[model samples]
Target chain A: MIVGDLSRRELADRLAGEGLALQFGPFNLRIRSNLGSFASLAHQLYEPYPLPEPAAISDFHVDISAPRGLRRWLRRQACFGIDGQLPFAPYTIEHAFPALEWGINWCVATRAHHLLLLHSAAVERNGRAIVFPASPGDGKSTLCTALIHSGWRLLSDEFGIVRPEDGMLLPIPRLIPLKNQSIEVIRKFRPEAIIGPSFLETRKGTVAHVRPPVESIRRAQEPARPRWLVFPRWVAGAPFTLEAMPKSQAFLSVATNAFNYEVLDEIAFRLVTEMVRSCDAYSLVYSDLDDAVNALDKLSQASDG
Target chain B: MLVSPLADRLIWQEWDDIYIVYQPAAAATHVFNETTVLILKCLQQGPLSMEVLRHQTEAALGVSQDELAANDFEFATTRLEELGLVEFVDDPSTAQ
Candidate 1:
């Protein structure tokens, strides 16, 4: 009900008293729950404009208003109506909106034509996209946060939705979630960065989110051709390094890490093959953000040269 | 009926300019260039004999018979068959 115009606190109260209704780009969602859990649901379901303060109280608890039996069914199926089509899962109440945004990211990812989802972080500057596809604890987010604060545009902090049809990296940039030392590391690097509240003792070890820069959000529709595929690893006390990886080996690495690669079938294979062929693949190991940024800058300059 | 029946079993995927398709269980793989995807999509409707495939491909892709030959259509057919996407179909009239 014209929900996008509401302020963060008003939106929170409205969602609590009434229900959750909001739109994110192309998708719209409505959730009905009691006041107790509505706060969490609200934060998760909507991207609070002019992002709320770090210590601001975020209400994450709400009670389901549906009948006991229907509630059980909704949970069991994990399905929710999106634009009237029942999606694979409901957007459950997350402690932070970033988590819910990630769910929305997953939702849009499946609908793209022949696009494979990759567990990576991508950032762009001057039309060139750099993808860091890696597993959890590989320090991709930390690297991405560092890059964005250093003037790179964040494409996405998690999934690298690569369209197989055109080999373009679609922008699905959201808040970059950081954990434990990464949060502190980024704070030291970019003190002005807007960070969400940290959910302590989470499975990912005290998780927090770095708000994506506004420029990235403004250019959300822009698609960039991947120029570098860097698989980063955080190694304590290691010198900042970038090593070239073989194309054949790089192909396997990317295919295995891709989210919807297998589902996209032949198109997935072709897109990845094209991407790997065109971009220079490297393995980056670092313990310091400054050193890593310097190394990336050198690479960027060389490409331009 | 003109396309190889074995072509049905083949799995082909092209991304950008590079193409790779293979049958793992059959232990066969084939690679093609940008032109192969157009060829595969044409054959996807059903198996076609080599002559018919060539003629249809010529019409669909707007290439001359000689140009089609230059693309190594015969080699592509063999590769597709090896990948199990196309196969030989018995002509019913001949059998009768």
Candidate 2:
């Protein structure tokens, strides 16, 4: 069953009562929430996701709800709890869905050490995937959003979960939260983008979420072998430039930028070295999205990884 | 005095001219330039003075030793010592 199959009342009821069991990529999350606002937004944004069996064991039991004490009655706030442990401070009540999204990402990135977790965005075309290792102001999510809308399949915008045993990228196509001005950028780029309500004064200044395309959500189980590592940045009025980076330098950047490079240790060294060796690495700078897209599309077609 | 490279404790990965060495004992990883890697390779034979290391590094990197090259050699070995990848040891011959 898909989330869209359920009515708003039914979705809310499932969330409040026994919890709503949903499959997010490889994870089975049984989300339990009592907040009406969170439920309404989640139902809208996650309508494309498939539901796991009600009796299936959940990898995580996540709670998004108002904190205890007078805070729940006055100037309301939301908190995230996983398996009875509150991992973060309370956010304003309206940021509950963002809290839920970010909380889930934290749970996976911190707990799932068995897989190589990279702070990157990945998208696939023709059985080949390109990974954009994320850094501050790198325009990773923006490029990922644009690519997915323009005929590429979205592997993920936040988590780059690679299976160490085989070096394949597992798709965890969740909500892509566009922050501040990027929200407007994406809206103008894709007029038909299914964005949830924008919440202001949250942690990331202002934020809005773009729902994953239904086709991408439906193909969540499909994993793609990574082919290219492109480090991208958006600079105002800069001409498009894509330059080859030395493999050793690429290794350092990718390893140091990973969320758990130290935790994995030798496995990280081996896999990262192999990944860089197998793929061509480049540094890209562009001001225009059209030029960026065309260049990447051309690269994907021109060479084999 | 001579410098000793702690090669026994390191895990080295090479791609082209650069090396990624992981010190499992310290749980630390470091990227080595060609010069640093060449110095470590030369020192693995035994502790060597800067004069001896300079000759070996020049041969390995295929460069003629001059003032600038010697300075770069000192810089590389200094970096190795800073990273605890190498240490100074008393030369046995001199002790005698």
Q: Pick the candidate with the highest TM-score.
A: 2
Q: What local lDDT score does residue A41 receive in model 1, on the 0 to 100 scale?
A: 39
**Model 2 whole-model lDDT (C-alpha atoms):** 0.88
Model number with the top lDDT: 2
- DockQ per model, Cα: 0.06, 0.60
DockQ of 2: 0.60
Q: Write the per-residue lDDT of candidate 1 for residues B1-79, one digit (tens) a residue.
A: 3554444355554444565665544544455665555667777777666677777777777777656774477777666
Candidate 1 — which residues are off by over 4 angstroms?
A1-5, A13-102, A105-114, B1-96
Per-residue lDDT tens digits of candidate 2, residues A27-86? 999999999988888788899899998778898899998888887898788889999999
True contacts kept of each: 0.00, 0.55
Docking class of 1: incorrect
User: Which tens-of-lDDT digit does each residue in A1-305 have in candidate 1?
Assistant: 33345655776565546445543322234444433443543454235423333343322222233223667555521223334344333433343243344445556556544457887899888889999989989999999999999989988888887866688888766667798999999999999988877767643568787877767766776889999999999999998889998766677788789877766666666677788879999999999999999899888888888
Separately for all candidates shown, the number of backbone clashes (residues 3 or more apart, or on different chains) is 31, 0
Give model 2's docking category: medium
